[model samples]
Target: MKFFDELKARGIIDALSNEEELEKKFNEGGMSFYCGYDPTARSLQLGNLFTIITCMRFQKAGHKPYMLVGGATGMIGDPSGKSEERNLLDMETLKENIDAIRKQLGLFVDFECGDNAAVLVNNADWWQGLGFLEFLRTIGKRFRVNEMLNKDSVKSRIESDSGISLTEFSYQVLQAYDFVTLNKLHNVSLQIGGSDQWGNMTAGTDLTRKMNQNQVYCMTMPLVTDQNGKKFGKSAGNAVFLDGSMTSPYKMYQFLLNQDDAIIDALLKYYTFLSLDEIAELDSKTKNEPHLRLAQKSLAQEVTKLVHGQEGLDAALRATQFFFGEKIENVSDADVASIFEDTPSVELSSEMLNEGGVIDMLSETPLFKSKKEVRRAIDQKGIYINNVAIEGPTQTLSKADLASETALVLRKGKKNYCVVKFK
Candidate 1:
């Protein structure tokens, strides 16, 4: 497929300027395209996932993808899609955030080789040294205040009860400047971003055309959302972060694995590099036996491997096995720790287990919320020690209760499992 055709097939093209001309330019090769990322947070969420993926596609198709880190612009937050002006990040903090984000982007796009070799650029390089009068007289004159104020991003904020600040209101000019700088210095012709960024991206295209009389292109990708129409990053109120420190690989894998049948196909197309045949086959299997959840498993596995590594993928898989009624006996202690590191656990002394019955131990951890629930589950043959169901809450702790001499896996039911460790 042609480069842009593939993008459209994958639904990555939310909007693009002069589609015919841009496609022709891409076909000529060595076309420089860029998408900017502001460091609003320490880590990028799922909303940013599509843009990075699209950038990769452009690179693979023989176009250079410049990943712009808004080191200078992030200090003045973009007003797009905001109810109120944001609190600015200090220069020290913005620099740190820019470096962290650059590292994250490095994982997605390979900048070392090929005609489509990716590169990271910071606007701070140019925006930092410009004199106040130089900026006002040169780039600032290209934008009209009347036209800027009428943009959707500005208009919505202005019409809201919370008024906009000059810092945020001038955000478009800074963004437009980034585009013009890239176009002149690096010959960057294309600017890509989210749908909400259409206004800012076009502002860049227009600025390039007016200032340099150069034809620049712009494109955006739709927001990655769940079938329920809600955003996709939240895992029970906590976001699924790309940074392993923020969200562990095991948890991140599980979040993708738990995707409902309704959204798996669309997400696979957007997130994974799997061929259409493979996706269609997975889709077929999913429709045949929705219970199997094979597609969701593949999605989780692929994404985990991409963000984390093979070791992280293995950890997530091991975690999945434990959830599928498997025991911790054959698993390594390190793997066990990596998986259940976040699940609540109570460290028990060996003597403590010896002194208390199963009921007392269960109650001590507050696993059941009450002793009565623990007794009821045990009486109903629902509670398990290690992987085997318990007959009664009165069962005494024996040597068999400990797994690998350090851990105990308790199954409250099919879904709820707890791990207890011996210090």
Candidate 2:
């Protein structure tokens, strides 16, 4: 299939400039495209992964990707999606962030695919030593203040209580200049970003036209949201960090696994490389047999494998199975912590591990609440430790009761679980 048709079929195209010409360029299949990221965070989050996957699609279609890290722009925040202004980072921090992002970008796109390889770029390389006054006179003079004021990003900020700062207002000029620079240096003709960036991205295309008489294309993927119309990702209050140390594979998998049934088809298309036909089948299963959660599992597995690796997916699957009551013996501390990071936890001294009984230990936490509750749960066979049903309520905790190095799982009923940690 042609690239544009696949993009349309997958529902990936939110907005783009010059649809006919861009489609022609996509069909011709040898143009260079670019996606820019400002190092606002040391690690990219789930929202950024959507664009990365889109770049993967482009690369698979025989196009080159220029992954641009905005070291220069990170120093002055983009106010496109913000009500309040962004906190600017210093040079040292920006350098560290750019380096980290450069490394993370490697995990997604191929930096060495021969002629079609991805190129990691830092805009600071070009923007650093340019004379501020000269740039303002040459490039800044091209933008009309009326058009700048009319941008949704700028208009909203201007009408706000804080108002927009001069620094942020100039962000578009910097971003626009990036396009012209890339077009001159690398023959990059297309730019892709999230829907929120429509204003800033189009600014690049227009600036490219006005400055050098070159036509560049811009495309955006819609900012994904759930059924309730709340803006998704970090804005939805369920932010997942792309860095493994920040968010574990099990957590990322679980996050995708809990999507609403109504949005699975859209999410599978956006997050996974699955064909529309495959997503349609999953969507059918989701509607017919919601209980099996086959669609959700596939979404989780494909995304986790892409972000993390097959090994990470395997670990996540084992952790998921362990959560669902499959016995996992000799569980390590990292697995327990990562798997149960959000589970309610209570810390007790090592003395409790030796002297305290299960009833006493569980009673200390909000889970069991009281000795009577623990005793009742025990009597009813509703209590489990490390997924194993206890023999009786009379036994005390010992070193052997520890599922990992310093923690043991406590449960009341099937779903209620607490991680009891010993110092």
Please state the error at residue 60 of candidate 1 in Å.
Answer: 0.8
lDDT of 1 by residue, 1-423 (tens): 777676777677887788788777766668899999888778887767777887887787788999999888888888877777677777787778887999999999998886668989999899989998999999888888999988999999999999898889989999999999999998999998888888898899899999988989898888677656765443224477888777778888888888889889988889999887899999999999899999999999988898888988986787677767766675555555666766677777677566468887888774788888888888888888767777676688865667556778887777676778776
lDDT of 2 by residue, 1-423 (tens): 788998988889999798999898887778899999889778888888989999998998889999999999989998987888888888888888899999999999999889999999888899987998989898989999999999999999999999999999999989999999999999999999989899998999999998879989999998887667666555346678898777889999998898889888888999998878888998898888999999999999999999889988988888889868976557777878888877888898889877578888878986866899889888999888889997788888888888889888887788888888899
Candidate 2 differs from the real structure by a C-alpha RMSD in angstroms, to one decimal, of 2.0
What is candidate 1's CA lDDT for residue 333?
54
* Pairs of residues at least 3 apart in sequence or in different chains that clash in candidate 1: none
Q: Give the worst 10-residue stretch by lDDT in candidate 1.
A: 229-238
lDDT of 1 at 96: 81
